[model samples]
Target: MTRSAAIVLLLLSGCTLQRPVPSEPDATPMRIVSMNPCVDTILMEIADSKQIAAISHYSQDPRASSVPLKWAMQYPVVSGAAEDVIAASPDLVIAGPHVSIQTIAALKRLGIPLMQVSVPETVDESKKQISDIAARIGHRQTGANLNAKIDTAIAAAQSGAPPVSALIWQGSGLVPGKGTLADELMTRTGFRNLSSMLGLKKWDILPIEGLLSQPPAVLLAGQANMGAGNADSNRMLSHPVLRNIGARIKIAHYPSSLLHCGGPIIIKSVARLAEIRRLMEAKP
Candidate 1:
């Protein structure tokens, strides 16, 4: 072939090589790590089976998560340490606001994209937090649906109830006060939380004697303290002073995950309390 023709062919080959090759878009996180139980539940609810890499150990507890134990068993559980998280090398990581600040800082330094979730102290705040997490994970629709469910449950719970007072017992004689999720749940479930009237904030350790003397008509106990064979519940139930309260007393169990950390599960917690309230009202 002529030299000119050969040069033209070479140029044609070079041009063809320079043309861009069409490629598929990147996948949306095939591996995810959740450092908090709240985030773990949210992720598991929406993430594809192949996408979840690991979750916090707390997700294994049925009381703490909606995920079944069998499902939780399929994934590795991280204890919220930098080493464990780094080893997972997940495409996404979720951490709670209460998670160790130092661990978060370390993960950030390592250039991991960490999503921070806040613990809601009120029902309104819980809704906002759930929405934020859902939006972050591209599940805004799911969040909206869940929010509607929560609203309906709360409304039903509040219907047809007289002015009833309630106290929430966390543990070790601690009661949650005003501006807290516990208070909000109690209020939404058709009862007034006496803690707010007394102007308490956060969880306060109350004297057992004082509580017995002026106990509310209904008492809500934390799930941790109400679990079967719980010594704390046994002691409280067996207390002589507690048994003598004139007002009707009922033990309502609050999910520790919802009350302790605050998340989407709070809606379920409200529903549970509402059921308890219905049962209490039925007693003649």
Candidate 2:
């Protein structure tokens, strides 16, 4: 029999001796397939390497993944398809809030266990997510340890001098405003979020004309580098008018991989912010 067929047979036979039963206290998933990039990082960090059957295809892309490419490449990539999950025969499938309803429904129909992680808006929410996922995957201790590291990094990043005004300008002009993890990170890292400074609410677009009229001292542009190629074509970010405005601003490049997700990425973002703040201080 093929490997997938054997796995399906094992599942059908109710092989309690090999896999952890749902009611077990150590109900760890013997095989895990992550459908979300954020979940991919969490699983990679808290679960044993052998337990991971596959991670999101985005995890293998450096531009979108929080995990190192070398490490992420060690696992197979899933495209959020139910068939892929079935072929992998993972004991647990983890997805993000944005996953399609069709995918979720398909998984449920196949009697697969699913963990949907909500988008965290605050630091406390992020911590809770880490703890929740860890416990679900039977890695409570690992989760606690990772939280300690994030807390320490946040403390260190919080230290230093007064905050500076900065704008986190993602591609096409979308900006994370108040009540978002990005907003919280900015406050912790000694940089005031210009979106909040301008009284912009959550999910508000940062107007290019407004930005050019009253430029921030620092611009945290994600995915705006020249190598981004035609990806920035016709986008206000790469428009010639903004170039003049960008020249007067200290534009610091923040990785998009570190922007959206909550996991070990938080610690990395905090550290990167510290370096950026230091550079701004050193300027004439």
Candidate 3:
């Protein structure tokens, strides 16, 4: 072959030997499995319904999730079982930091991609987590909007009277102290958590009798009618020792789901608590 023909052949050979261009990383997850209630709420909010392969059954309960039961009923659920999750063939799995270690390990062993979210302990942390999740799902704008709403609600709530001494009743006379999201929420709503005043951290189990002796200015109960039939609330209100306390006691029924979950619904919880605080201020 002549020089030009040889050069042409070399070029053709090089072209034929070139590797194909790598495909772009898949930005859209085709199948998503949510193992935690909070994760389920976030995924539902940010991702299309068709992108989700399965969710936890707890998402079906209105009490446990902000999503309507009807909406939850429309989707299949894995209930966080390893076998069930594997069967769903999810491209991604979402769970909370508190999920069972064993389950996490099992999923890892199967080479499943897992995203673990932490529960927020403060308003700042809550905002950060929301932004993080939103970015992960390509919903950063939605997250920013939700954060703004939360800040606005908290500011509105705090604009009123000086902080009142308050107690957050979790259950069985257990109250969330300092270093808890409940405590942070109470503070954001213009209440000085008595637990924080006492320098306590986490949920402290106090005898109902002790609370009666030194009642707070306001009693904030999680979940309306939570302890109504139980001995806790009844004991707090009906206890003869508490009858003479001058402070106004009110039951703020913030659903555990809203309070416990670190998602967009936290703004709703803050708004509800603000309403309760206003009611308390109006009372004689």
Candidate 4:
């Protein structure tokens, strides 16, 4: 072959051998399954609807789910069953640190990629969790924006009003004490956690006599209404004595979902507490 002809032929062959440009990088998870409700909520916020294979069954329950039930119902749910997860054929399976060991072992045995996210105990930890998950799913910018919103809400809540004495009272007089997310949130939102004032530690139940002796400025009920027509369950919160005492104190409702998990709900919870603070300050 002539030199020029040979050169041209070689160039053509090189072109033929060149690989076509790949389509956009698969940033989204092809098939995602979440075994934890908290992970399900995070995935819903960051992942595309089509990318989700299945979500935790707890997300389908209105009382326990952080995400809206209507939105959760749009996706299929799994009960953390290894067979169900394997059958879903998910490329990435997200779970909490506390998921069943058998399920984790089964997924590992099958060589499925499993990501375990732990429950964040503070606002900073919660933000880190969001960033970590978002990066894992190739949504770093989304995670940054979410963290920004959380920070703004926190600042607004802290600056809303002066601190008031507040007790996070739940069913059976249970109180979240120092070192808990609720305690930190309450302090940040301009409230002195009565749990600490009353010498209650983490996860302690307050005695009725002790609480009556030292009343708080605000009684933040974990449930909006604990009146389920059950006398035993309602005795502490609904008793006429407690109701009479509540008349002199600020009573507010704090949802159970906001307190259980840390994520986008922190924004709403902080904002709500700020509003309550403003209202309390406005009161004569």
Q: Write the per-residue lDDT of candidate 2 for residues 25-88, one digit (tens) a residue.
A: 3468878889888887777778888888889998887656678889998998888655576677
* Cα lDDT, model 2, residue 67: 81
* Pairs that collide, model 4: none
lDDT of 4 by residue, 1-284 (tens): 85435434544454432322222234456778888888877777777788898999988986568899999998888886665776677778888987777678766755677778887879999999999888877789988988998999998888545689988777678788888888888889888898877888888988678788789888877543565632123246656777777677777876667676777878988987888788788888
The CA lDDT of each predicted structure is 0.67, 0.78, 0.68, 0.76
Which one is best on TM-score?
A: 2
Q: Which scores greater on TM-score, model 3 or model 4?
A: 4
lDDT of 1 by residue, 44-161 (tens): 5555678788998877866455556787899998886666776787666778776776667656655566677776787778778778766765677877777777788777778476
Q: Give me the candidate number with maximum lDDT.
A: 2
Candidate 1 positional error at 259, Å: 2.3
TM-score, prediction 4? 0.83
Candidate 2: what lDDT?
A: 0.78
Over 4 Å off, model 2: 1-26, 197-199, 226-238, 245-247
| Candidate 3 least-lDDT 10 residues | 16-25
Which residue runs does candidate 3 get wrong by more than 4 Å?
Answer: 1-26, 222-248
